[model samples]
Target chain A: MLDGLIVSIDAMGGDDAPEIVIEGIEYFLKHEGKGRRARFLLHGDQPRLDKLLKKNPLTRERSEVCHSPTEIAMDEKPSQALRKGKGTSMWNAILAVKEGRANTVLSAGNTGALMAMSMLQLRRMHGIQRPALAANWPRPEGISVVLDVGANVEATASQLAEFAVLGDAFYRALFKKEHPSIGLLNVGTEDQKGHAVIKAAHERLAESDIGLNYKGYVEGNDISFGNTDVVVTDGFTGNVALKTAEGTAKLIGKFFNEALQGNPWSKFTTMLNSVALIKLKKRIDPRGVNGGVFLGLNGIVIKSHGGTDKVGYSNALNVAIGLAGSNFLEEIEREVERLHDEDDNIGFIE
Target chain B: MLDGLIVSIDAMGGDDAPEIVIEGIEYFLKHEGKGRRARFLLHGDQPRLDKLLKKNPLTRERSEVCHSPTEIAMDEKPSQALRKGKGTSMWNAILAVKEGRANTVLSAGNTGALMAMSMLQLRRMHGIQRPALAANWPRPEGISVVLDVGANVEATASQLAEFAVLGDAFYRALFKKEHPSIGLLNVGTEDQKGHAVIKAAHERLAESDIGLNYKGYVEGNDISFGNTDVVVTDGFTGNVALKTAEGTAKLIGKFFNEALQGNPWSKFTTMLNSVALIKLKKRIDPRGVNGGVFLGLNGIVIKSHGGTDKVGYSNALNVAIGLAGSNFLEEIEREVERLHDEDDNIGFIE
Candidate 1:
């Protein structure tokens, strides 16, 4: 009886496999997915999925189980996963999308393995030389989209330009903004700062009239400050910046905990401020923004945090539904042609 | 009646130069520098420094004004600063060290300009190809030293090794740790992770017996977790990582402030937790760790934050005093000889 946008899921993915996946679907249905006509294709062990589904009637009623013989291990190498990844839950989930059986595919599995398998099965879009993995960053005000977080180790001048177009289009489609401002991640905001590749990209974007509202270069700190809607960078720097921010947030959380358990007076005061403190805690909770969308692909594939619980997984599922329902795929397709034109006209004077 | 551990001060460098520079010396002498035999040679506009010195009795008693005719502008390019930098406060401060008139030099000026002037005046050590900028990072527990933060854009395999040696020595000298553990900053901690330069450095550091307490690779979060005593990376990545962390901390502080302006109950409770909250603020305050030591040079030069106030400048003065007193200079010199051997023996198989 499920009759809307279908989402294929690798149920055997993540640290707490199958359990969180089933519970996540249940959480999504009762909460954010309440009235939406969204269904899921659960790909995992038949017996395990059956028992878990029985405990959650809503998910069991809406979803159809697609039996997968084997499961991919969390620590398996990408090459090994690619060599023998077929018929596995992760593989079958993507296969559903390839066969047009599902609107999108999602996995909380090994990132390298998933990227490799997704590339092999779904194939790249029209003119993307390298597909980017766009991750959401929680800013002081709202969320900002950062791309090429860890898709490729290095990015060329032309490829950085490609990311700007992809990121700009993706931001506009999801946020429904007429024009989303984009900025390149760099050491400094000045024109002459950072490496050769970044400088070249800045020059190209500043000159080209590709309809992107380019905001020039933004520093690492600017990502958290929400200076731009979308931030672009090479995979190496982006990955490091993302991890560093995560670590800083965790460290402060630990300090906050330790501060509360000090003197009796301090401990008593913390209880008095519990309501405001709770709001502060909820705002910074990592579970709120819990998905990385694999962009420039043939089909929509969301990669949730491997260690996230049911609540976190629900947020990622919400992201999947949000993107799948929008006209993002078509919008990106149009941008790709314009991007190709920009790619051919690079005249680096520096 | 000025005594031991003489530090040359660039009185006309920072945003609020001459004023904070004189007050910072006074603050240091009263607080951390109290009862210690520390003296300063203030380099800047004579009449301004002389007028400011009259306001501070302690600094007036111990410091001597070495009047420089001009000052380096905060945003001056390195090349431009170098071409016309003679007799300027920043230039003369480094010159004082070159002439052996002071034990160390401290500047709160243009970072690029300072680096360029320092390199030219003091020159590199016996085997140092590039001198690194060692910055202090506030951790949950104590502190960590991250190096090559914007000293150079990119680092080769051997240069990274040199950084490790310099960082290890720097950490030991500052913290008084017998064997400080050093970690190479990378996207992942795995042995097979990161770019070719990183992989080569990791292999060399892992196999070499260069008398360093090497802890292999560490991710970005590890820097805040106090997982290692020292974290080393190329200048560009290090600069980005440092700025990103600063921004995250600032964002969290903003959230806490907004959380308190909710309702009357929240406002009443905030006063109760004021003691503990103040303690938490102090724990993450940027002013506490204020200096970036220029490593691999013949002399010691501490770069105070350009925008920092008197309190922050005072902390930078403390760092200058700490290293100037210790044999950090000699320790780095000893390690440089061993690092040269590691550089020549780079047999990168992969």
Candidate 2:
């Protein structure tokens, strides 16, 4: 029996639906042996989940399948879904966290709907001017946390500063880094490089003693390197940049495969250089690190790709466990309080 | 003796300087063979270039070296350097294109400096609103051209429409497509998804006809795929997204190598998957497609990376020749006129 933590998995959330999600959850449970025990609650149509359970026995001892009648489509407007689809797998998963039935929630479908449901259900942490969604981008110096990927399109200087604090907390909790470096994404690294919003935020970050090893301004190209552990930006630019990177990686992979596949000579070359190819694939695979946790929310919430596979879904569950096991909430609260005290001293934003 | 197009390469440009640039020019000449006779005039410190040339026996057969007294620092402000460093390799290379000594100009140096020099020397095309920097991103179907990567940060609706025209012309000419589909990059694909600039530009694009197949709006995630032939945006978002993708690819490459090189078992696995690794590497390697061609200028002006290697420099030279080989200037002029005529008749942009 799992007595360590509780995590709710949206079994019918992703594009491939119950089959992939169920298999992924099973894989995660099997891999995560007896040492780290977490109670798994599957939220979806009970009948469907039961059918899958019959096919594959989940390794976890303590688990339950909760029935959620409805579902939000990938194309549905987030706000509308939150208002109407209250019984959806996504909504139920969020509701579990709200009711203390689950300490964390994981969903691999409809990111917008998940975010909306999370905000509406869990509510934001007190003094969080705006809730931000943080994603982990694998950098040369390990992984960096980038917040405001798509939570709020427009933000004030104070909100950007808040994101930095939250991101620093996240990096510390997950990576166990001390005084993680924080950077503000701008057109250039110069102090006077970006627009008015960024300039104001830069000043705020500089002045604030938020316990961050503030790295000052960082350009778009520096985000991928080990240059900074946390990058803060407005949702518009961050969201676009993240999606663009993902799309570009996929495109490059497709092109590379097509250009070097299906020929005798090509196959021979491929055999000769198989080591490099495997290494490269592992490096760019989004599934290698799935479920970007929605930081700054009351509880741990993970946003996975809508088109995720079985392995991807499984990875999302593991990410939720990581967030919970690392004591993310406690760390964030402490950091938020530290920032709050500093803000109060310097006349904090109301 | 060169019979075809001629391109002036800034030999002193980029981080590696005259050595790598000279080698790149030699590689280009050697690969071009006898039939494709294109002259590459290396512009830099004749003495330094001569010393670098001694490493390789490259006679002035299909290539020549021109003396440029000064060199532009990558970190120097563009406006200040443009006024002071008149005899720099970057400035002289642009001047060569303007003076009809070279049909195209390519540089692996400061992008801002190149843009300033190109704008001052060749001048913007008549009827063209503002010059836009275009980069070709590989996709599943083929490659798509993205415009205004970093030319004008705050662009007007008129400028974006003009970019649409230039991008359409370039896409058609290079891809040899009868009707190239063009998309305006925005937060969402809906008509009213973005701010004032995008809203205004969306209306303008729908009305303007430079023989473009208007594909409405495209989101960031769709950029790497051939959802549209040409993706148009203001420099601010475009530049951030492009650099982010490039940086992400570089980081991914670095991270994988580090992770795989840790142990003997992983190294053996990596070796076995070498074909996949090379295929993946080829996908993300910026050297394969190094430069962003400055469109809407009177002549072909290519902006290579400031930290370009020999292969990257060679690719930039190849891109310049490709631009010069095609009737870019004439087509750009014709497209502007066509767009203007259509806009006038339909009353698109006021």
Candidate 3:
């Protein structure tokens, strides 16, 4: 039997607060087969959590409620939150991981504050300058991982190369793929295209013996087409592409709905085919993949969408538990150390 | 009566060359109300052009065939095309504009070759360092213009600010909206969120008295939400976002199609609502907005997608004719000069 993994949860964060968080825990316990191999550390107002947890005896039996009087607001500035967030639920959850009481932390909170607190408490890994947020994007074949979504706006050539290694480790850990094909996102596929940083990063990644199956450059359309297993880019461009894809999907869905409701015949036809449409909708739903993992930190931290419901929040918790159960952190640390050793060997040879 | 505007067309370019190009011109002359106010300078092999023109009497009546024995291949490198591009049809069309024989040029040729030839022949406008390709993206309310889609991959703060002015003028010429609201595309809406270049550009745009209704920073989702009339960014980021949006739309469309063909019932539903669905498809068709206007050049040049059909080709021609009829080039030149004059005045005052 595997050792029981403990996931720290910031129950006071997100738009729905402790209610949705508790409900999500119940949903995960009910549906997830791996739920029996995990324990939970719920950080929030003890009184409210205790009341909510009473309805779900199984979750209450496997979870502990820790008191936290403060919570970060959704729109609070990162600096202000850092100054005043010592005892907040998000801070406490991260602290549990930092103190070795939990394997990982999961929060549906303000992304900037969560990233800020995680960086401060856990610190970056030995060879990493900045941590990146890796998002699991839905594609036709399966899902592809895209990194630096909004963690850092700009990335240097070295930082981009680091992102490739981080993304490679992430895909291996989550998908259990031995080697995932990685691509650097660019405007064009040619090596000569894009800016100097991208070209330099491409050269660095191509030349390095970092054990990554580095495919050359890929364009924006390749993200949805699943042309590569991992798509890496600077945070500003990645964030824009991610949000634009989301917005476009939403717009098309709206158009689809409007088209189905145009006439009586169309309405009847829609009713007849509602099941198929619902299946397609479920296949492409963003709620199933709601977490953005903060890579390159000493411990794992997952950020869930603030407005997600119990279903979405449960999915995020599942991702946290999955990462916690694996040796993801150790794998990344070992890879980074190995790459540094290789660099040292190259230096001596030169 | 309006003077007959001449639009130079490269009949040898695009996937469906002389046939589709000639058919598109016929289609435009058949239905377009402003067809009587414009004439076409058809540049290609004289024999092929004459044969295609014989089939469409109206197009032949309104168009004059120009002999161009050489043609640039779609896969030809920009440098190679630039070296030996004198007698090519794409070259002749642009040369007509440079020599003031045509008000504008339209080509569905290779983008790299078109950009290179336009830069070498027509040249850049005074005070403009690089030209930008501005694309009209469809939004729910109407349309928004996004610039530097794939022109120069990297941009300085001043270049980004200049794009805002170029985009503003393009929007005004096309949509007839004075003082179109412009926003800088960034990872977040907050002032301090993006990279140093974006921050500096934000300051430049916000503080300048350049007669622009600057709306500050906008996120990627804002492009489809129609939050701003113009969205400006570095070419690499803009190109990625644009292609990502296109890819997302395509993926959703595929899902929609698959759902509608799942069973006999869905097939029936699709049959019943075919008209409404077709209307929706037409509303969002990329072919209707096929042209990407190359801004900041001394003369106007429109690039059509190389694989587009007659419908798409006609739309590109319409865009060229529309801009040619308006004082689009003069508007850009005057606005750029005004901004430069203001900079000089500020320097003297300091």
Give the number of the best model, judged by lDDT.
1
Taking the true A–B contacts (Cα pairs closer than 8 Å), what share appears in each candidate? Answer: 0.77, 0.48, 0.72
lDDT of 2 by residue, B1-350 (tens): 74788888888888888787887877766664335678778899998877877765653566678899889988878877788668888888888888999998988888888888889888989998789999987666677889988887667887888898888888877777878889988777755356777788888778654567888888887888547889998887788888887786677556556766766766765565566667667666778767798998888988888787777777887777777888868987987888788778877664
DockQ of each: 0.80, 0.37, 0.73
Better DockQ candidate (1, 2): 1
- Lowest lDDT block of 10, candidate 3 chain A: A341-350
C-alpha lDDT of all candidate models, in order: 0.88, 0.79, 0.87
Candidate 2: tens digits of C-alpha lDDT, residues A1-350: 44778988887888888788777777776774335677778888998888888766763345788899988877777767877767888888888899998889988778778888888888888768788888888766577778888887777888898899889888887778888899998878766466777888888789876567888988778878646899999887788888887887777667667745745666666565556667667777788667788888899998787787867777777777777878777777787888878878888564
Alpha-carbon deviation at B28 in model 1, angstroms: 1.4
Greater DockQ among 2 and 3 belongs to: 3
Interface Cα RMSD, each model:
1.0, 3.8, 1.2
True contacts kept of 3: 0.72
| Top model number, DockQ | 1
The best-first sequence of candidates by DockQ reads 1, 3, 2
lDDT tens digits, residue span A1-350, model 1: 65899999999999998999999999999999999899999999999999999999989988999999998899898888987789899999999999999999989998988999999999988877788999888888788989898888888877888898889877876677888889998888877788888888898888878788998989888989866999999888888888889989998888888877678998887888889889999888889989898888899999999999999999999999889988888888888778677656654332
Q: State residue B84's C-alpha deviation in candidate 3, in Å.
A: 1.8
